[model samples]
Target chain A: MITRFLSEVRTSFNPFSPLSKTARTFLAQLPPDARATGMLIKHTILPRTSTQKPLLFVKFKDGKELKLDLETMRSTEVMAEVDRHSRILARKEELSG
Target chain B: MPPRIRLQTRQLKVRIYHHQIPSQPCFYASLATATTPAPPIEQTIHSVSPIARFPPTQPPSHKPPEVRKSQLHREYQSLLKSSPLVLIFQHNNLRAVEWMGIRRELAIALRKVDAELAATGHKDLYADAIKIQIIQTGIFASALRVVEFYNPESTELPTQHPSNPATATLAHGLSRQAHEAASDRKKKLDLAPLLSGPVAVVSFPAVSPQHLKAALSILSPSAPNFPAPKRKANPSYHEPAVQNGIQKLMMLGARVDGKAFDQEGTKWVGGISGGLDGLRGQLVGMLQNVGAGVTNALEGASQSVYFTMEGRKYMMEEAEKGPEEKKGGEEAKPEGEEAKPE
Candidate 1:
């Protein structure tokens, strides 16, 4: 299961691309339970101005919307953890299949 | 005396007495006449002489003028002393707004990422999406800090989570916890003297500066620190509007006072330090604790994930790979040399 998870994560698009090394390090720390619910989505209808950066609008399984920046550990770590969990789910699905 | 003697001898004596009357009447009368007006007359005539005129009025004393206290000066001094520290916290509203804007952007980013992952038919993407959403919620909560301090009487602002009920509920819970924490801190510290009349404590959302300003304006409409709310209309017309506006305002900022509910649309932003240096210190400490708690919670949440996953594995792999790679290169070098020699 761990090998499968690792393989899936390795092939997955790098979550670190948009994040800084520090942010990536922080993202690498999130717990799996933090991924179950409380997802947020930040939305920007238009491209950001030079002064501004875009935000993510997330919706959780419980129907919560949240806006977040990609730069911070708060967002990145959670993203990383979610990525791991989804891979585990995929591995389970593959086994089932 | 010669004239009295002549009176007895009528006409003959009257002529004799008239000649005798020219004589001085008394020596004492002559002496009295000499001394009477001499000194004042001499002094009046010779006025230029130093001793002649009445003693000169003593030169006006050169005592220094009394100094007076100025209220403006005192206020200026206080401002100078506290400006550096206060300035950072003064922008709390602005910081909150910036955070909210960031959160909004993040939410959009996560959604895009999530969509991309979903399109790829990758189950692994779901976790990333969920994680992004959670962070977005935290940012949103930070942004809503301004509305927490709105005045319900003057302006009707929406709550933080009007659009998203689930996040709003969580924000509300967090707000309650913050309030309880503040109250606990208040209890621990002596604030009785700092509280005046009916204690009104305003809590502005620290999510964004604009929200905090809006909240502060509700407390003091013309707070120099905050920009005025642009919209004139009450923000809380509908239930969702009220809920979201209030939550937004509460999440953004709040005013805490017994009279907060009494004011029509005004939400209370916490208390202004009642010029009591000690209470201000305590409140500052409390605010620091709150800020620290938030940061610590975020750190703990992030760190928990860091230890669990590839982070640990990555470190171990790096440690193991270092020596093996070096040894492999060295062994391969000898084999290459032997092949060349043969």
Candidate 2:
């Protein structure tokens, strides 16, 4: 998971639902020092009877926001999508130096 | 030279008589004529108790009993069965320091509750037994299945076998009967979904709302109902490590008395005023109110009927007096006539 390029993360999911596995996995993969390293992370846990799907929002350092549907997507797919944006940032930094 | 070791023919004890043949098949049959005896007389007369092949404490298990996983499964089964209240949490990448701080704070809070309970003469103090422990998710889920689905009565035989009956009647959580019951895919548990990932549980030996309130406020604080301890009251709680640990932990749900509850439901349980005793008091109050209402309803009907009768009698007296007053022009005449019963 390419988390260096991410600035913010927001998610809301019902833990009782099986579909929330990815959403929880995404949170678990974050570095322990993510907050100290200037990344903002916030999450909301829905009740058991809720009909809402798990939602994840990612904001990159260059002002690009990605909204993901975690109900249909897997943890690996989520990481790949985030890494796509991070790879571009990494390339630009290398070129500027 | 003659050898001195040679045996003399006269000294030999063997005697051969080819003319006399024995009736038995073997020559030794005449010497071993005793037959094997029958079984004990008591065993034949009465049904004997079945002897267990294995030790009473350790029964044969479906899975290997020597492994750590099996032991943990048994432990978790006991945990689920014993505790009436279990709060589940999802822990994310928390360091050891954070867990230590969180545990320390939790212990302090529970101790505070124990002190209060002791003051009021309540003996069911579970402060020492309650703890937040991380578990093997797969084993815990399997154990939960066994706890929820397996019934000891369903596997028991009507009559014990004459010998080694213990092997046939194994009803332990790790036995083949339990595994078969729990492994059926059709049966589902309400708490199954929350059993994945790095799961942790806070189990209470008994459901005490006061202790729950304290644990919730420390672990996941929501204002007014369950607020964080004040800085002045508890300085250690406000430490950064505890706060960080608390932040990473997300409360998933609760299982209370085998019933599943979400976050809102968990809070509702914690919000119970007082504890079991408080709930009992509320029930008593409601019943007393119902009793009072029933009595009031019955009394109201009779009272209304009585009032109606009194009103009608007063009206009749007024109607009778209307003409009497007109006939008796003087007031003194009316008073004297009334006294004379005219």
Candidate 3:
């Protein structure tokens, strides 16, 4: 996953819900020092009885925000969706620097 | 043929013995004494008890018994059974140094809690028993399933083989019975979703919310009640490795008293005013209040009845006394006043 371009991440899901696997895995996939390098990660845990869908919100370095519903999405799919925007940012950075 | 026989007798030489000559037997088997014959296979098989093939401790497992996964499954089952409170975490590529730092800080915080508890005359310090350990996610989930679902004493075990009871006596965590019981997909565990991707667990021997609060403060600190130790109070907690490790570790959820709880629920458990004793105290207080309310209600009804009865008795006595008391007072007070009434 291209996490370098991500500036902020907000995730909310019930840990007991099976659909929240993607959201949990996405959080796990972040680098250990993702927070130290100016990345903001905040995850909220909904209660067990909650019927709300799992959500992942990401803010890229270029101010592009992506809101994802992780209900049916796998972790790989979530990563692919984020990387689609990140690859462009990576190209832009390479060209400029 | 006659010539051949004569030649054999001619070539033979006879040897003379010095003492009384004794003839030795050609076969050694003839000289040996006879012993009792062995028992028949049928009698032996029927009479003897079954011999145990495997060791007493290491029972045969559904999976390969010697593998690390099977052993871990057994260990995890024991862990789940022993500890009523377990906090699960997702550790993302934390280094050795980071793990060490985190463990060190955790020990320090837990020991401090223990010391405080000791000062207040609390027994059963769990500072040494509580620890954070990385686990194989799949094995742990299987173990959790076995712990949750497999009830050996209650359910009937299938006949492995009636002829040989030695092969199928065990109902341990890694046994076939446990595997079958836990294999049902229809019955899902609430903790199933949380046991994924580099999982670790912190198990407590008992559900002591004070210790849990201390542990949560060190590992996954929230702002209000479970704030991280300040830099000045404990500078080691602020080290880069520990901080980075703490940042990477996401508090997934908890399994408390066999029930799965989310992050909020876990915090609520830790936020319990006191440990089990405190919870018991609260329960006692609530029950006492209820008792008091019930008694007060009953007293109110009985008191009202008593007041009504007293008023009735007063009215009855007053009616019985009638005008006798009034007549006596009138006679004592006035002689001319009696003449005024016609």
Candidate 2 fnat reads 0.76
lDDT tens readout by residue for model 1, A1-97: 1212221111111221333222222223322222222221111112111223333333333233433454444444546654565565576678999
- Reported per model, the fraction of native interface contacts reproduced equals 0.00, 0.76, 0.79
Give the poorly placed runs of model 1, Cα more than 4 Å off: A1-97, B1-281, B304-311, B319-327, B339-342
Q: Model 2: how far is A84 from its true place, Å? A: 1.1
Cα lDDT of model 2 by residue, B1-342, tens digit: 876889787766688887867667666756786777987987865447666677878888899999999999999999999999999999988999999999999999999999999999999898998999999999999999999999897665334455546546777899888998899999988888999998999999998998999999999998889999999999999898888888899999999999999989999999999888899999999999999999999999999888988888888987898678766656667678776897
In order, what is each prediction's RMSD in angstroms? 33.2, 6.5, 8.0
Candidate 1 lDDT over B21-91, as tens digits, reads 56666778656765455566645554433431222232111121122222222222233222211101011
On TM-score, the stronger of 1 and 3 is 3
In model 2, which residue pairs have backbone atoms overlapping below 3 Å? none
User: What is the full ranking by lDDT, best candidate first?
Assistant: 2, 3, 1
Residue B322 shift from truth in candidate 1, angstroms: 6.7
**Collision pairs in model 3:** none
Q: After superposition, how far is residue B162 of candidate 3 from its true place, in Å?
A: 5.8
lDDT of 3 by residue, B1-342 (tens): 466545665457686768985877667787786787998887565545456677777777789988888888989999999999999998877889999999999999999999999998999799999999999999899999999999998888764453575656577878888889999999998888888888999999999999999999999999998999999999999999899889888888899999988888899999998788899999999999999999999999999999999999998989877677787677755755756672
Candidate 3: give the TM-score of chain A.
0.97
